[model samples]
Target chain A: QQQVKQSPQSLIVQKGGISIINCAYENTAFDYFPWYQQFPGKGPALLIAIRPDVSEKKEGRFTISFNKSAKQFSLHIMDSQPGDSATYFCAASSRNTDKLIFGTGTRLQVFP
Target chain B: DAGVTQSPTHLIKTRGQHVTLRCSPISGHKSVSWYQQVLGQGPQFIFQYYEKEERGRGNFPDRFSARQFPNYSSELNVNALLLGDSALYLCASSPSFGEELFFGEGSRLTVL
Candidate 1:
């Protein structure tokens, strides 16, 4: 019953490089897709999110590429920094469901 | 401006004992959700509450229960703790539910 699937349990990226994490979900009803970043002993903070209507969304150093047909989404970090070393999670949910189906998770390490 | 807050950053309990975790949502946030994160795994949804009413639940057993207060704070109670229950219990709050959650640092429960 793993509803959301993520890849690469752990990843290593060099500083100034790019780090990517991917996720796919089984439930098509999922309308909202979000990525969260968590540091040790801290909460999961919202990084960026993309709805099904948008194919892609971008922030300062983060981007969310979404594919509606594939039921997949990915988070890309540009100019990865050592400060970006943390665990990342992808989640899916629909309106009124309240429950968010999360992927296994990916630990990203950006070496300085 | 305060974010979600959790109580007792760490706790130790014996098997068959009980533990209670607390969470206070961000200011003006009305929905509270709970999640469990085991080592090397993603967070699994446990429960959600909106307006002091149950909104959703996950596939956890009956030993886990939660409730929300009028102030949008919530509590999670687990009875008869098992070794498998040793993990980081997370609390999240949102303006509504499903997506856009602000999470707490979490309460780590170690069952012996």
Candidate 2:
């Protein structure tokens, strides 16, 4: 069973626009939610993360808005750039378990 | 410090063959995890090791196995390779369980 489900298999956005990708998980035990960015022929890299305690976390142009009760989280990129074009994955995991459950992934293309 | 490093950036194998992929964690990082990513999909956790001990494993068959060395490096071995096994195998390293992880470039295995 896939614990986390991400929507919008592919997305296209203008360079300076806002790009949003959403994900929902089933396991309530999940406390850590992180987003990873991956370029072609490369491994996924940590982009941003948010814990259940906080409603949102922002790092520069990347932001993670989480809703604990809804069991959902969304990643928003402000002023999206061409460099941001890549595959993004949303993952969830519990405190003790080091294993991460990942979503289906979303491919974003930012047009210049 | 240098980031996580993986070996043999790419490999090609035939059915029924066996292959081994290697990974070296970042300096001072004691935890390593393996993930499998197929085309157009997210990464699925395969196994996690910390301090030379297996901390977590995914729902993979016995044909898939991994071990960590004393230096925090790891090797993933797959026996009797199949066409379905062709995918990108990624290795991630972290300071500890449930901490921020750094990923390597990954080894792309193409099973013919």
Candidate 1, residues B1-112: lDDT per residue as tens digits?
A: 7889999899999999999999999999999999999987889999999999998888899999999998889999999999999999999998887648888999999999
Complex DockQ per candidate:
0.80, 0.83
TM-score of predicted chain A against the true chain A, for each candidate: 0.96, 0.97
lDDT of each: 0.91, 0.93
**Would you give me the overall lDDT of model 2?**
0.93
Give one digit per residue, the lDDT tens place, for model 1 in A30-93.
8888899999877788899888999999999999999898888999999999999999999998
TM-score of 1: 0.97
Worst 10 residues of 2 chain A by lDDT: A1-10
Q: What is the TM-score of each candidate against the true structure?
A: 0.97, 0.98
Instruction: Kindly report which residue stretches of model 2 are placed more than 4 angstroms away from their true locations once superposed.
Output: none
lDDT of 2 by residue, A1-112 (tens): 4479998899999999999999999888888899999999999999999999899999999999999888899999999999999999999998966688989999999999
